[model samples]
Target: MSTIPTATRRRVLEALGVGTAALAGCASAPGAKEQATEAETTPQEPAMNAAQQTDVDRIAADPTAIPDPIDRSEPKTVSVEMTTKEQVAEIEPGVTYTYMTFGDQIPGPMIRVRRGDTVELTITNEEGNSMPHNIDLHAVRGPGGGAEASMVTPGQTKTFRFKATYPGAFIYHCAVPNLDMHISSGMFGMILVEPKEGLPEVDHEFYFGQHELYTTGDTGEKGHHDFDMEAMAAEEPTYVLMNGEKYAITPDRHGSPSMSVGDTARVYFVTGGPNLDSSFHPIGSVWDEVWQQGSIAGPPNKYVQTTPVKPGSCAIATLHAEVPGPIKLVDHALSRVARKGTMAIINREGAANPDVFEPEA
Candidate 1:
C-alpha cells in the first residue's frame, strides 16, 4: 500500500539485473509485491520486465565489422640504384674533408615509397677497397633484409628485392660483422615506407647521414688534421662528416664555403649511430616536417622547427639553401661537430665564395 522504501527497491532492482529467473511464476506471489517495491526504488532501469512481456521478440543484435587494409599476396616493390657517388663535406670553415659515400652522398640517397611497395635495389660497389658492402633495409620482411645473400663485392654489383610493410622512416645499413666499420666507412642510408594512411608531402627533401669512422687518428698537431694510429686505436674516429665530406655543414665565415638564399633545400637526415643518436639541427633553419618511428603514419609533423634525432631516424624538410653563405649542420652534440665533422659551400650566382651566411647575428 505505502510506496516501497527507496533503499529496498534499489536493492531488488540491482539483483534482478542478473537473471532472477528463479522467481519464475512466483513473481506474482504475496512476497512478489515486496520484491517489486524493492526494485522500484532502484537507480538502475528494470528492462527485465519489458523483455518478459515479449516472448516472441526476434533477437536483435549489432554486428561490428572492420575491413583489412592490406593484401599479403601483392606487396609493392621499392628499387634503389646503389652507385658510389663522390662528394665532400665541411668539418670546419675554410677547410674540406673528403670521404667515400654511397651514390656520392653519405647517408646515401633518400628512398621514398608509398604504402605496400616492393623495393628492388641495385647496389653497385666500386672504386673502394671495402669488400662485400651491402644494404640491409630495416623495412624489409625477408631474412637479413636479403643483405646476407646480396652484396656487391669490390668492383662488383648485385640486385635484391623486398616488400615494404609497416611504413616508417627506416634505416638501410650494412649488416656486416664489422658493421660499425662498414657504416663508419660511409655505407648507410634511409628508407621511407609511406603508410597506408598517407601523410603530407613537403617542398624539398635533403638527405644526409651522421656516422663516425674508426680511421687512424691524427697526432700531427692538436689543430692539424692528421691520422694518429694511437688515438684511432682508442676507438676515437679521427674525422666526422656529413654526406661524405668533412665540415660540409660548417659555414665559411672568412670567405670560404657558402650557400645561396633562394635555394629550397631539405636535408634527408639520418644517423648511422656508432651507438650514439644525433640531435642534428640547422643553426639557422627550422624543420618544416619530420618522419619519426621510422615514418609509419600520419601527416608529417609540420613546422617542427627543431626535432631530436635518435640513431637511425630521418626526416624531410625545407631549408633556405643557397642562402648567400654557409649553413652549419651540427650534431647538436655540438662538441663532436666542432671536434670532428665536415662542411661544404653552396655558391650562388657567381657570388665567388658566399662563405658563411650569418644573418645579422
Candidate 2:
C-alpha cells in the first residue's frame, strides 16, 4: 500500500499548525482564553509517577477481539461485564497520554448479542481510578441509555438491564458531564445486536474504533500530555487515531489483521468521535457490501468506495480479498492519515491475482 512520504507528512503537519510547538501560542486563538478558563475548572487526571510513565500499557484494543456470531435460534439473557480504567499509555513513541477507557482498551470490548435478547450489563469503576464513570448504550431504550442507572464512582459497580429490541450496531460511551473529554480520552466502544437470523458469514471478522485525541502538547511531542479542552472545543485534534494510538493497527505498530487472499472479511467499525465525522474508506479495495450506519435490518449498499460514519455511530462493511497485499483502512480525510496518525491495515497473503491487480513490473 502507498502512503504519504515522510517529507510530505511533515509539510502537512506544519501547514495545519500541529508542529511540536503548535500549542505554544494557542492561547491567542479566538475563544481560546475562555476555553482555557473553563478548562481550569474541569477535573483532570492526576500526573503519573516515573514508573507509571515508563511502564505504560498499550491502549489499542485488538481488532480481532470480538464475540462469535450467534447461532442459536432462541434469544437468551446475556450478561456483560465491563470495568472502567484510567491508564497512562503511549499514543505514539515517547508521547504518553492518560486514557479513560472501558475494559482497559480504546473503544472498549465489543458486546455482541442477538436481537430480542435481554442484556444485563454491569460496569465497575476501578478503585484506583480518579474519576467517576458510566455507560450510555445507544441500544438501550431507557433514560440516558442506561447511563443514569450505571454511574459508578471509584470502587463501585452498577448494573442495568435492557432488551436488545433492535437489530443494528450501536455505540456505547461514558455519559458524564464532561463526556466529550472522556470520549476523546477513549471512553467508548461498540455493541453489536445481531438480527435473530444472524449476519452473513465471512472468513474473518475484525473490530475497530476511531476517535480523536486533543492534547496540550504538539503532535508527537515526547512526554506525558494532558487533555486539551480548548482544542477539543475547536475540534482541532492532536491525533485522529484508530484503536487509541497512531497507526496502532498497522504492521509497524501492534500488527495488522491478516486474511488469506480469496477470503471475505467483515469489519465492524465504531466512530466514537466526540467531534468529527469519518469518511471511512479502505485503500486498494472497495467495500463489497456495506451495512450503512450499521443497520443490518436493511439491504446493504454494494461496491462503495467510502461511507460516512458520524460521531457516536457505527458502520459494518465487508471486503473481498481478491489480491495478495495490504489494504489500508483510513478516514479518507488524507490529512489525518498523513499527519494526525489514523490508519489500520488488513494484510492478505497468497499468490497474486494478476487479473485483479497487476502493478507495473
Candidate 3:
C-alpha cells in the first residue's frame, strides 16, 4: 500500500509544462500504436555485447564499485535516520504539496534487487538541516559504481553493501555535487537488479515518473511553496511535476481514476534523466506489451505507441482501461501539454461515485 510516501516516478518532461495530454479521454486501445519502428534497424534490439555494454557502461559510470580505480572504500556505517516531515501524497487528486521532500514525495523509492543480490541500505537524512546525502547504486559490481558506498554527512549516518551483478534498468542517483540539486530536491531511486528468476508478476503495478525542481518561485509556479537555496544553487527548477502534484497520478483518489474496466494497468515509466526527454503516451490505451528498456531479462516488445524515455530510462507498458472516461497519464511530450507536465485522471470503473473525468477547469 506504499503510496511511496516518498515519491519515485520521474518524467517531469517539459520540466515545467503540463502533462498527460491534458486529460486524454480514452476509447482506442483495441490495437495499433507501435512507433519505435526500430529507430534504425540494425540495432533492432541486439547490440549490447560491447563487453557487456562496456562492463555495464563502467558500472553505469561510477556508482561506486571502486576496488582500486585508485583505491577507495570507507563509507561502511549505514546509520541514516533523518527522514521525516511527510505530507504531499497524490500523483493526481486535489494535488496539495509542501515540497522540499525526502519522504514526502519527489522521486524516492523502489530499490529492489537480485541480479547478484547484495543490497544492504539504510538512509535517514531528516529534512534539509541534515542534508548531505548519498546513494549511487546503478546496479553495482565495482569501481565508483556504488558511489564509494553511499556517502552521507548531513547529521551523519552512512553505510555500504554491494554485489548486484547489473541485471538491467539501474539507477539510484545522488552523487551530490549539486547533483541536479539532490535529484530535484528529492534524491532518486530505481535499481531493479532482479535476474535470478524474477520479474513478471503483475495483476496491477504502479510507479510513475517525472520531476525536475528548483522552485523558490521565479514563476515556475509553486514547488511546494518555494524554498530557495539561491534558487537551489542556480539550478533553476521551477515546478515541473507528474507524480508529486497537479493531477499526480490520479486513478483512485476521486476526480475519476481507478482502472478496472478490464484491469491491466502496469505503467512504470521513469525518466527524470539529468533533465527531461520523455514522450510516453497512453492516450486511448495502446501498448499491449512493452518492457522496452527496463529489461531485467527482456521480451516484451509488441504493441507500441509513442515511447521514448531518455534521461535515465525505464518502461513497462500494458494498458486496458477498456474504454474508460479520461485514462490519460501523459508526457508524450506533445509541447509539454500544459506547463510543468502532468495528465492524470483515470476512472476505469467506480468507487467514490465515479462520474468519470471532469474535475472542472
Candidate 4:
C-alpha cells in the first residue's frame, strides 16, 4: 500500500527511526479546484494593470531576498506595523500571479517577541486596496484569533495589544470573509513567541513560508494568472510554492540564503494553507531537533523525518548540514512536487563527509 519503493522506504524509515507511513501521502485530503473557463484562463486584464505590474516587478526583482533577521533580546513592548495590499507577481519565469500581500511581500515580515512581552500590533489596509482585511494570529488568546477586532477597510488602520503568554512559532494570516480567496492570493506570515529561556543558538537561521495558489491558468502556463474563488473554496490549488515562487530561495534563482556544509541551520517554517496541510520534510537530511507545531513549551522531537504543519500554523525544524549537496526541502506530497511548485534547496558547502553518505560513479 506504500507509494514509495520498498528499498527506498526501508532506508528512509531506518534513517528516521520510525516506521509510520505519515510521510507517504497516506493522510492527504482533496482540495478545491478552479472551474476552467475561457475568460478565467486568458483574462485581457489581470488583477494588475500595466503600471501596477511594473511596480511589483521592481519590488520583487530580487526574488531571493529574505526578511530582516530578528533580534531576540530582553522582553519589551514591541510595536509592529503591517500593511496589506495586492499586486501582480511572477510565479516563475513567464508565469505571473496576483498576490495579495502583507508588507508588499508574499509571506510578509517576521515578527519576534519574548513570551511575556506585550505586542502593540497595527494593521493597515492601503487606500488602493479593493477589499477589507484582518489578521488572525494563532498566538492570540481571544475571539476569532483576534480577527474580529482587527478588521480594516481600505485606507483604514486598526491597532490592538496582546500579551505573548506562551512560547511557540505561530502563524498570522488574513481572516476576511472570503478567507480562502484572500490567503491563496498571499496574505500570511510567521510570528515567533520565544520562550523566556530562548532557543538554542544555531549557526544559521532562515525564515520562509509555503502556500498554494489556485490559478485560472494551469501550472507552468505562460502569461498572467488569475485567482479562482471556486478552486480556492474547493481547496484545489494549481501551485504549492515556497517563498511565493518556483524555488525562490535557492542559489540558482535568487543567489542567496545558502548554508555552509558544517553549519547547523534553523528553519522557521509556516504554512499559509487556507486548505492543504504541509508534510514538512527535507530530503537527504534528518531533523536533528524539531519543535513540533512550533511549540517550545515541550521537549523537541528528535530524528523526525516529516511533520505535518496544518493550515494557519507553524513549526520549527533544525538541520545539521553534514554533507555537501543540495538539501531539498519539500511538502512530501510527491504529486505537488512533480506538478505544483513545492520545492526549495539548501545548498551545503564543505568537505564531503563520506562516512555519513557518499555516492559512487
Candidate 5:
C-alpha cells in the first residue's frame, strides 16, 4: 500500500486554500502520522468471495428515520444522547471498510428542537473504542459549539447544555484535532432547529448526510480497506456516499423513500464532506421550496433546480412528486454517481401525469 507523505499532504491542502487552522490542526495531531504508518505497514488482502463475508449489514442511516416535529409553542428543555461506535461494514456489495460512527449509523440521528429551547446534549464513547470523540453542533453558540465541554474518551460519557437561539437546519459533527478524517468516517448529523412560527407542513420528510470516504483500495475493490488520509488532503475520495453505504438508499438496495404522486416531501440534507461541495439535485423534479444553507428564518427560494451545500453545512428542500416514477437524487457532479458511488432514489408510486411528462411509443 502507498501513502502520501505528511509534507505532501500539507502542500496539497494548502494549495486547495484549506484554512491555516485545519493545516495546523492536522500537523499538530499525532493520529495522522500513526495512520500513515499503519497504512504503510498494513498488507492489502485479496478480494473475498460472498461465502467468506461476515459483515453484510450496512451502516447507512435510514432517510425516513427522523424525529417528529416540535409541537410545543413554548420553549422547553430537550435532552439528546449519542454514542460513538466503531465497526466494520460493507460500503458496497463486496467492498468493506471500518467506519467510526455516532449511534451505529452514518450521519447519526436527526435531532429536532425548536428555537429558544435549551438542549442538554450528552455523548458516550463506547467502551473498547480506540479514539476520543466530541461533537460540535452548528446550532449551538458556545466554545467549539459544545465540543469542548463534551469530549469523551473510551468508556466515558460527558454532558453539556446549549440553547438553540436561532432557527435553521444545522450540521453537527466531531470536532477533534483530526476532525476531517472523523467527519469523513461518519461522525456527522443534522439538527433542525425549528423557527418560532415553524415550517410549513409536508406530506413526508427525509434526512440524508453526504460525506466522502478515502480508502486505501480503489473503488469497489473487495475486502477490507483502511482509511487513506492522503487522498482526503488531496480532496480525492474512493467513494462519495449518501448516508454511509454506496447507493444504499436506492430501491434495489435498502429501498428508497416512498411517496405518492402529487405529494410534497421535504429533504433535510447535511453535507459532512470534510472537502467537497454537493450540487444537490433531484432528477425528474425541481426543488419546490429550497431553504438554502438550511436557513428557515426567511422565505424559501421557489422552483430551484439545484443548490450548493458546502462541507459542514446543511440544506432543506421540498420536492413535489409531480409525476410517478423513480426520482434519482444526485450531487449533479455526475462522476460521483458514475464512478465513486453516490446516488439515491425517491420512489413515487401513483399514476403518471402525461401532461407533465409524456412518452410516445
Candidate 6:
C-alpha cells in the first residue's frame, strides 16, 4: 500500500468536490515528521477477518461503578489503567467508523477520583494498534495535563502520576500531535474529580460524550468509508453523535436505558469536540440544576435551558422528568441534528402530567 502525501491528499479530496472549508481549519499541514512517525508505528499483526466479527451494540456503564462521594478525612492513592485499541463499530445503520479508543469503547470509560487524591494513571496502547496515543486530562494541573508523559506507541505502556487538585467533570482525551483527527476518530472521555463533599444524589445518572465524525462520504452513507481530512479541517462533520452512534441512547435502539416519570436524571455530559462546540439541551425539559463546566466546587445554577459544552470540556445537568414522553437530547445548533446525527432519547415512563402539558384533540 502507498501513502499519499498531505498535499496530494488535499488536492485529490478537493478535486472530488469535497467541502470547500475542509483545508482552511487544519492547524497545519502534515509534514515528514508525522509521516515518519506513522511509518515507525505501523502494526505488524495480521488484520482481523471482518466477515467473522460481529458488532457489539452500545453498552452503558453502570452508574454504581462510579465511586460515591468521598470522605475527605482520608485521602488515599488511587490507581487507574486504561488501554488503547483500534476498533471498528457502527456509527449509524449500515455505516461504520474506525475508532481509536480507551478500553475499546467509544467515548472511552469514565475515570472517577476524589479531589486531593493522588492518582496513578497508566495508558497502554495495544500491540495490534498502528499508532502512538496519549492522554490529556483536564483535572490534572500539570504539564500537558500528563499528555507529554503518557505518549505510548503500539505494544507499549506509560505511567504518570497526578494529584487531583480540582473538583469538576473534566475531559480526558488523546493529545498526541494531530490529535484532532484522533479525537474525531473517537479517542475521548470524561474524568470526574469529585469534591470532598460529593455531589447531590439523584434518582438516576447517565454518562454521555458528544463528538463528530468526518467521513469520506455523506451522512447515512452505507458501507465503510475512510476518514475525511478535508471535512475535519472545515469542521463540517458528516455525523455528530452522542455515545458514539445514531440514537444510541433511545429506548428503541440497542436497549439503551430510559428514565421514568418523576425520576430525577443527572446527566454527566462531556463534549469531546476536536473542533466544534456543543450547545447541549434536553428538548421538552429544563435543567433543574446545572454545574457549569461540570464544576462540582461551585453551586449549581437553576433552570438552565442550554449550556455550552465547549471542545474538551464537560457539564453536569440535572433534569426532573415531569412529563411522560421521549425527551430528546440535542445540541441546539439544530443543523447538527437536522443534517448530521447528533441525538439521543430518554423515554419517560409512568403516568403523564397532562395538567402541565396535554395534547388536545
Task: Candidate 1: list runs displaced more than 4 Å.
Answer: 1-79, 84-100, 127-130, 196-201, 219-235, 249-266, 299-306, 317-327, 342-361
Q: Assess the local accuracy of residue 1 in candidate 4 as a C-alpha lDDT between 0 and 100.
A: 46
Quote each prediction's TM-score. Answer: 0.58, 0.86, 0.31, 0.81, 0.86, 0.83
lDDT of each: 0.54, 0.90, 0.51, 0.79, 0.88, 0.80
* TM-score of structure candidate 2: 0.86
Candidates ranked by lDDT: 2, 5, 6, 4, 1, 3
lDDT by residue (94-150, candidate 2, tens digit) is 788889999989889999999999999989999999999999999999999999999
Q: Number of backbone collisions per candidate, in order? A: 67, 0, 59, 7, 0, 0
RMSD of each: 27.5, 9.4, 22.1, 12.6, 9.6, 9.6
Candidate 5 deviant stretches above 4 angstroms? 1-56
Q: Which 10 consecutive residues of model 3 have the lowest summed lDDT?
A: 52-61
Q: What is the lDDT of residue 280 in candidate 3?
A: 78
State the lDDT of candidate 1 residue by residue for 98-209, as single tens digits: 3345665556666777667777788777755446677788777887887775666778878877777677777888776666655665667777665665544433334456
Q: Which stretches of candidate 3 lie over 4 Å from their true place?
A: 1-114, 117-135, 138-145, 149-162, 165-171, 180-182, 185-189, 201-207, 215-217, 220-228, 231-237, 243-263, 269-323, 328-361
Give the number of the best model, judged by lDDT.
2
Better of 4 and 5 by TM-score: 5
Write one digit per residue (lDDT tens) for candidate 4, span 197-299. 8778788887778899887666787777777666677777889988788767666666546678879988888889878999999998888888888888999
Better model by TM-score: candidate 5 vs candidate 6: 5
**Residues 30-115, model 6: lDDT tens digits:** 68567657767996432221221224544223322344545565678999999988877777666766777888676788888888
